[model samples]
Target: MDNFLIITCVHHFQKDGKFYGYGPFIREMNLWIKNRKKVTVLAPLIYSGIPGKIDLEYEHPHLNFKSVPAYHIQSWIARFKALFQVPYILLMIFWEMSKASHIHIRTPGNMGLLAMFVQILFPFKFKTIKYAGNWDPKSEQPHTYKIQRRLANSPFFTRNAKVLVYGNWADNSSNVVPFFTASYSETEIEPVRKSSLKEKIKLVFVGSIYSGKNPEVGIYLSKILKDKGIDFEFIYCGDGVMRPQMEELSIQLDLSENVKFLGNVTSAEIKSILKESHFLIFISKTEGWPKAVAEAMFWGCIPFTSPVSCVPEMVGNGERGVLLSTNPEEIYLALLPYIDDEELFQKTSKQAMDWSRKFTLEKFQKEIVNLECE
Candidate 1:
């Protein structure tokens, strides 16, 4: 029996005698442990609060969960408190590492950082590291993220492990594998019927309403489009700390009629929105794979996104989708041509869907199985 141990920083919750966590993360994990007889998860557990719309329950026959106290070092006080918890966290990881036959580490996180070091002590054990963050050598990131990236790329420390990262990087070791994530399966691919530009343009933003995701940029873009006398409707499909402020901004800008905020809807609802929408406005400052972009493209929604991470490659340097700029006017100018030209919009939409369909959940599962066998 394959004993699989997963170490992650994603917070899990227990409800009605079931384990739940962030929807997308949980979905991917379900695939990873599909064939394993025994599965152990080491993560933080939240004692209270109901699962959000995007939280999902884990579907495993035999699962063992080990809870670790969550800690962050973002502030001086936080750093001081985390100091005392280090020994306990390290000991927990080491004990789990000693028994597991196969270990999987989700990286660019506090728990993953510790597990990365612990796995080094068991070099002969088969392991896989999923670096679920920006792996670009030049991108600015937190100190701990950089450290995790360095360790993952070092063959000396990460032996007998496949380090799966979002994009292909030039400065990586032999074990570092370029990987892509998928939200939809081949069975979910359907013919998208999007409305023409002559009708009210339908734009959607499907991510966190936080600073890093740049949800405010979507509002600013809506203002630019409104000023240009372009009849449009902008929808936000996720929630965060900035939702209230963004809601107020919409009313203040007289965009309350044109903008709608649908806080944290189910995956099915998001797919339905993508099918009808003409464009996906996602100007996030950073991402690993940006599942939202891929999901949008899967539904024939052309994305207007920033040139961050592997997005340039995903968009084919403006062939499949528009690469955004910080300036709203510049973004407006770039977007106008696509809106005006039906041929260009249709062609680009097709290209985007074709590229995204190649990375479906079916293909992702096969890759995971192959990694385990290797």
Candidate 2:
């Protein structure tokens, strides 16, 4: 019986004697711990009256949860509070590390940073570090993020650990392994036949409607299409604090009829929408793997996304989908070639489906099992 310890920054909620967390994160964790006899999680805990629509419960028989305060250094007050809290958090992590057979650290987060250091004390213990962030050496990131990356890739510090990164990076130790995330499974693969682009083209966005995700760019693209006398429908799938502002912007742009906000829908609904949509417009400022892009591709929804992190590799450098620019005019010009070209659109869609199908949930789970054996 293996005892697995996972330390992450993902917030877990407690309600009615049950634990819930963000859907995608929880789903991936479920796969990691499915075969283990006992699972222990060290993360921030929140007592909420009700879980969000996109939250899911952990599926395990034997579970141990250690709650830690979530902290940030965005403000002076926060920094001061974190300074006092770090010692307690580190102690908890070290205590947990001593008891576990295997340690898993999810990185590019405050909690992950502490865990990375704590794991070094047990140099011979089996460990895995999932660096769920941009692994591109050339990309600019926060100082702490860079520190975490360096520590994870350093053999002397991260001994007996496999550092799982999103993209294939050069000049890394043998422990640094390139990995991918998946949404659908082999059994879920179905023949997706999308209708040809017509006067009414369907464009969808699946993610938080916030500044970081740049949801406004989708609206601007819709405005451009409308101004060109093209009939279109833009759908926003996820919700955030920016929804109200984006809704107002859509109204101001006279896109009330063309834009629809389906805030926080189920995964099934998003998959269904993706199957019918013509394209996924995601012009985010940054991303790790961008599950939305991969999910969109899985359903043959060609994603017009910014070339961030591993996105260019995922899209095959515009062969599977268009690499987007935040500028609406530039995005329009990039997309103009594919709009009316049915043969090109079909070819790209096929390419996307073919590439994305290679990374199914089945494959992801098998990879996890292989990692555990190693």
Candidate 3:
């Protein structure tokens, strides 16, 4: 039987009022657990008051789980605790890595660093590091994230591994590979229809409204359209730290009536909105690969985004959607023509869906099979 071990700092399942990381990682991890016979999960387990369950059920009888003490350095006590807990975490990972034929790591976390150092001891070890954040070095990142990337890409440190990253960056070691996320099937193709040139355009932005995402960009652009006597409306979904700021910005810009911000919505609700929208405004400061862009494109919302991380590649370098620069006026001017052209809108929507469908669950499963090969 093939033995497999996964190491991550993110909670696999939650017990308290807190949720774990987003659903994409949870769903992807479950794919391996359900398909493999001998699999052991090594991660922190939190005991809390929230409802928590695996996004996908495990059918394999041979699956096992081992919980480790959660390690972090958020506060003074937490830092001291992390210093003491790290050794035990290393021991747990070392033991599991030695026994398992496959080592899978989920990164940009404390456990990821320990796993990286442990993996170095076994130079010929078969492992995969899922770097699930912005891959570009030019973008601002935490010092820990930079260190992890350096270690993961160091030819002298990490060997015989495939480091799955969201976007392709320059000067990468042989280990880095560009990856994508998908939610639909090739067979379930539904052709997206664009509105007539004379019709009012609908623009949608989905995701947390943090300042980093710059949801105000959507609001500001809509205001610009309104000022130009263009017919358009903006809808926003998801809540975050900057919700209050967005409210103030909308009121200050006098876009309270034209722009609507709906918070903490479900996927079905988001899908309903995406189906009717003609374009997606997603101008995040940084990302690994913003799932919302792909999700919006799947439903035929032409994703207009800042060329951050792998967004240029994802949007086909403006073939699928418009790439924003540092200037908001430039972004508004660039998107005006697409809003006025029905044929360009429809063609781009179809191409975006076609490109996005290639990275579906079935394709992801195939890659996993190849990676776990005995």
Give the per-residue lDDT of model 3 (tens digit) for 1-374. Answer: 57878888876555332234345566677676666669887887656523232132334567677789987788999999988888888898999999887789888788898898899988877888889888898889989988899998887899888888887678688888777665555665676666664777888888878878888787778778888888777888888898888888888988887888887776667878888888888888888778889888888888888888888998999888888854668778887677667777788888887788778778877777776463
Q: Over the full model, what C-alpha lDDT does candidate 2 score relative to the true structure?
A: 0.91
Clashes of each: 0, 0, 6
Order of all candidates by TM-score, from best down to worst?
1, 2, 3
Task: Give candidate 3's total backbone clashes.
Answer: 6
User: What overall lDDT goes with each candidate model?
Assistant: 0.90, 0.91, 0.78
Clashing pairs in 2: none
lDDT (tens digit, per residue) of candidate 1 on 1-374:
57899999999999988899999999999999998899999999999767888999888989999998898888999899899887899999999888899999999899988888888899999999999898899999998899999999999988999999987789989989899898888998878878888888999999999888888888888898898899999999999999999999999999998999999999999999999998998988889999999999998899999888889889999888988776777777877888889898999999999999999899999999888676
Question: Model 2 — which ten-residue stretch has the worst lDDT?
Answer: 46-55
lDDT tens digits, residue span 1-374, model 2: 48899999999998777788999999898899988999999999986546788898899989899999998889999999999889999999999999999999999999999998899899999998999888888998999999999999999998998989888778678888889998888999999989768756889999998899999998898899899998789999999989999999999999999999999988899999999998999998888999999999999999999988899999999899988778988988877777868889899999999999999888999999888687
- Using lDDT as the measure, the top candidate is 2
TM-score for each prediction? 0.98, 0.97, 0.86
Q: Which has the higher TM-score value, candidate number 1 or candidate number 3?
A: 1
lDDT value, residue 211 of candidate 1: 89
